[model samples]
Target chain A: MIAIERNLVTPRWQRVALPIVSLVMASIIAGIVLAVSGHDPIGTYQQIYAASFTADGALTATFIYATPLLFTGLGVAIAFRMHVWNIGGEGQLYMGAVGASGVGLLCGGWPLPILIVMMALGGALAGLAWALIPGLLRAYLRTNEILVSLMLNYVAGLFMYYLIYDSTSFWRDLTSSSALVFPQGKNLLPSSDWPGILLGSFTLPFGFVLGAVLAVLLLALFRFTRFGFEMRVMGDSPAAANYAGMRTRRTIVAVMALSGALAGLAGASQIGDFGHVLDPRGLEQAGYGYTGIVVAALAMYNPLAVVIVSILIGALTNAGFALQGPTFPIGLVGTMEGIILFSVLGGEFLGRYRIRFGRAPARAPGLDDEPGAEVAP
Target chain B: MNADLIVSIAVSAIAYGTPLVLAGLGELLAERSGVLNLGVEGMMLMGAVTAFFVSQTLGGPGLAVLVAAIIAAALAGAALALIHAFLSITVRVNQIVSGLALTIFAGTIGLSSYAGQVWGVGGQHGVHQLVKLDVLGLSDVPVVGPILLNQDAFVYFSWVLVALVTFYLFRTRFGLYLRAVGESPRSADAMGINVTRYRYVHTIIGGAFAGLGGAYFTLAIAPIWTDGLTAGDGWIAIALVIFAFWRPDLLVVGAYLFGALSSLGFTLQTHGVQLPSEFFSSLPYIMTVVVLAAASTTLARRRIGTPAALGVPYVREES
Candidate 1:
């Protein structure tokens, strides 16, 4: 039998080697899938690479998908670090979109800088409120947050449908006959549109800049704060945290709120940076919230790694979008994301244990007969 | 407001709820063996898409084709679950993440959709739809007959499965070993139960059940193929297992209860009830959260039924 025993200290070489190996393995598996399904794996991959990077405006388009993913990835990474399992990022993002769009609509006459700040805050606060439901339940009532948070996502998605298709709410475009018939969200004024920094060829979004800053802030928060210390203790062992008189309950709520706020910021970015309107179908189709979890997992729940991972995943998503047709299927991105996660998740074992191949060790000395020893006829 | 409306809803409830019963029972078996597979949705989709494809391509007698399709679906789901089993059990990875990976790999946007596109199964009507059984002419009887007796063979099989599983779980020694493995794997191992074997077998069996559930979508309920056609029913099925407290007998109750909530939107609308369609659509999801919260609260008080070793990878040797 094979045995795995936990190592007191993980080897540094193993830590660095595992992720690279995992990615290579995932690519090979995806290649096999392409080959089996009547496609040239190498050619298809080269095409994806070209669409995502080499083609003109591809990098700029990648940034569009990357911006929200960066925000949501950080959001998910923070929550996962605490083992909170806040899978409600999808719902929280929708609520954030609602909050940000509401703010943007009402504050259209305000200056761009002020309007953007209010919209971001509004989105963050709304997401926090939405996340607090499962957060409070998990902390106080001991409800399973995974299912609760996931259920809320369905509810939130339906709510978005209600806002756009069913009701003539403020967000609905009632003024335009074409929009009224189609039932789309009202557009924000051009003043509310976020500006981007023009690079030599690629344009960098304001939201992506904000996410980078947030990543640094989050790193600092974890590394240099008493709250972070308490949170770490609580996450590792809640019972120990309780015994130590740390506010584990408050930390639970705070972490969830922070996570939800990050997802909300993604929603705010969706509105301010790209969509400029509450496009329900478009937002739902993007599924950036779910993809964010993939980013967070691939990054090993580290906020800084999340920045780089988000761009890489964002490029894949853009390639999927750009190449969607008879030749390229839309499902490839999700399948690759899943495969990547599976590889990384399995590779997590390298850091945790050392496997020994041998016969089972001789049993430790015992009574030799267990209690309730078998009595047979 | 009449017997006809009530009867119609009741019939549809059982019809719609059959998939959940199939899937939830599978999840219950897995959870009872200490494997919390969150990939039921993905497994179900694989089953659904594979079953549809087989039913379309395979040439045989109608019944034989469907049976073959069902088997193919089960194998597809089990194939995915094997990955999950190997990862969570052997690799000692986090089960939650492992299951989510399976979902992402085989889910609506993943392999299932890819397979659907590759097979070109979309926009084609199911030629081999599940026919409702007359059930010894008892289907012609009063309201109970239509509600209970008029269900197809798939629904009846689910009932038999529920009964068989209930007996196997409670009465059989093997079931006892399975429960022991989940409750306390260390103790079970000490008791000479093969914890690894039981967990692997049961988790894969659970995936098979999820496959049957997904097959129901194409063969029986909707009679069509579409990406994410199961919607969020698999998630609801996962929640139903909690509502059942991991008992097979109670799983049927929870499934049909949610089934009624699922059919409510369409049933009531058909009966001319005026309400926002989305509100009706969200009922099952909302109710799942409510019931799960309630179940969790009750569980916290009772402190029973949950397998102690759930989501924890068992290692015989110490660090």
Candidate 2:
């Protein structure tokens, strides 16, 4: 009964304070680092905040940049909640890009509606296929998903490189002057683009709605569904779940595939709406996929929390441009992002476990005997 | 297609594999000690850039290469690993998180690029190239003699070094202690072994080897410095350790195989092969993925064997 009650304690304060404390701490440390580096830290901070928020066109740019991160973050969150560590989001993203680009290039003269559906399906299928390899390996072979997924990122990267640079038949554009053989893909018609519902100046695209709806639906599924209950049980302790007769392997594959599809949607949506051409550099920034992991960790794998975390991340990215100057290269943005992520995560522990001071503790002989209890003080 | 191509391929493999062997062995040692140092790439790049400048300033490729590689890569890797060691062993930080952070710190485009510019002109232009180390009297033999006997000093040094490492790991008392720390630091600690000291020393030694591998690249293979020049070789070195099944002896074969695949791109290009350059370029990643996937299977992993506490941070008291 005591164990059950302890397990039932929902982490509420941690769910709220982690991000806020982390952000504040990051800003403070960033200020100190900037000052020591001889830059005017005050001006830099102001510029970043203004450019990301108050500046004209900043919000739109932020949304455009963040759309992929939103989808990938949720993708990561979905798999993470099911106890599947899917680090192959990068690979899945690339596969999705390949799929969507293939469809886009092939159906140039097709109707808008048909092209949209085809591109979406192609992207999702490609992502699903890419993810399935490791999923099966982890589920059946009991291989480490972390290593498999991480390695697959490289494979997917290579595949992208091969399509662009080697196989000319599928992705090559001989007509282009550049040395790189551009994968020929059908360009998206404006009609096929994800329409943005504007409010005053903000143009929130259909992707936003899809992301929000998915987040809510996932939260609901985790909260109410029997499958979700089983998944949660599996995540908490796979051995226990297995002993209880849950089909852990099949569930792992299902969750991972779902994760891959979500990431694929990110790639498709980005290309369909914002990307002008299909090329390697069009990968936005390898930020979306990895950031999804950070997001998952930050939100503690809660689907509902991912929404708020995504927005905060999106805003910071949007705001990062203002900090750029001739003297300080834009790479500072990446460094700052890393600092922010690490600091927040480091700070998150405070919210979860309370640390008390004034110790005069001596270990008892049976200290090792107790699994959760500390040595008596 | 002919005999010369085959000879060249074999020679290129040796040249390419030397650095990988050096790096892979270092990672093997670290992982064996139960600390996965993923910052191998950053350390190598740092070593490559620093070695270029040091060699250029000091003249004489032999001593300059040694000094530059040791000071830059070994020292740099050690310093980075110190951070990792502190976080993992002391603060109980997650190994993956610490590793990723270290990589980001060292791998930032700004840091590496700036270091390259400040160092000097690299990429086939800046420093004196290493002279080939010919084995005495054996150079005059037939095809096999020329191919095998005549090579750079680092190639022979790498082979000798790997052999020594294998011996030290399997045949020495200290080696047993190191292995024990890796398997279970708590058990090692309770048995009167200094786990922290062993982990630190071995981890630093591992860093030094990785650094030497990075230096080999600047001094030999590319013979120049470029930002992010080590590319993903450091990461590959980590993967190779896994592929080699944590045995120092197998590292020689695995590294050379990877090295051959890496150099195959340029070799094929030299012969004007019709294959796409991208396919050739991405061979390392593809091979790494295939190898890791194959090795990761439960049946295969049992056959290959992994360090018991691989990737887990050791907390003596917590146990």
Error (Å) of candidate 2 at residue B87 is 2.5
Q: Please provide TM-scores, in order, for all candidate models, with all chains considered together.
A: 0.96, 0.86
lDDT of 1 by residue, A300-319 (tens): 88789899989999999999
Task: Please write out the lDDT profile of model 2 over residues B1-319, one tens digit for every residue.
Answer: 6977887788888888888998899888888887877767766766666667676666565565565555766776676677667666555555665566555545534334445544444444645656676688696576676678988777888888898889888999988888888887778889999977877777777777877887887777766676667767887888888778889878889998988998998987898887777677778877877777777764464655477776666544543
Worst 10 residues of 1 chain B by lDDT: B310-319
List model 2 lDDT by residue over A140-253, tens digit each. Answer: 877667667766776777677666655655655656555444344334545556567787998886676777788999888888998888888887777778999999888999
Error of 2 at B142 (Å): 4.4
TM-score of 1: 0.96
- Which prediction has the highest TM-score against the true structure? 1
Identify the runs in model 2 with alpha carbons over 4 angstroms from their true place.
Answer: A1-11, A28-38, A80-83, A105-118, A170-186, A284-287, A315-326, A348-353, A357-377, B49-62, B108-125, B137-148, B223-227, B297-304, B317-319
Q: Write the per-residue lDDT of candidate 1 for residues B154-233, one digit (tens) a residue.
A: 89998999999999999999999999999999899999999999999999999999999999999998778998888888
What DockQ would candidate 2 receive versus the native complex? Answer: 0.33
Model 2, CA-based lDDT: 0.71
Give me the runs in candidate 1 sitting further than 4 Å from their true place: A1-5, A12-14, A355-377
Model 1 interface RMSD over true interface Cα atoms? 6.1
lDDT of 1 at B18: 93
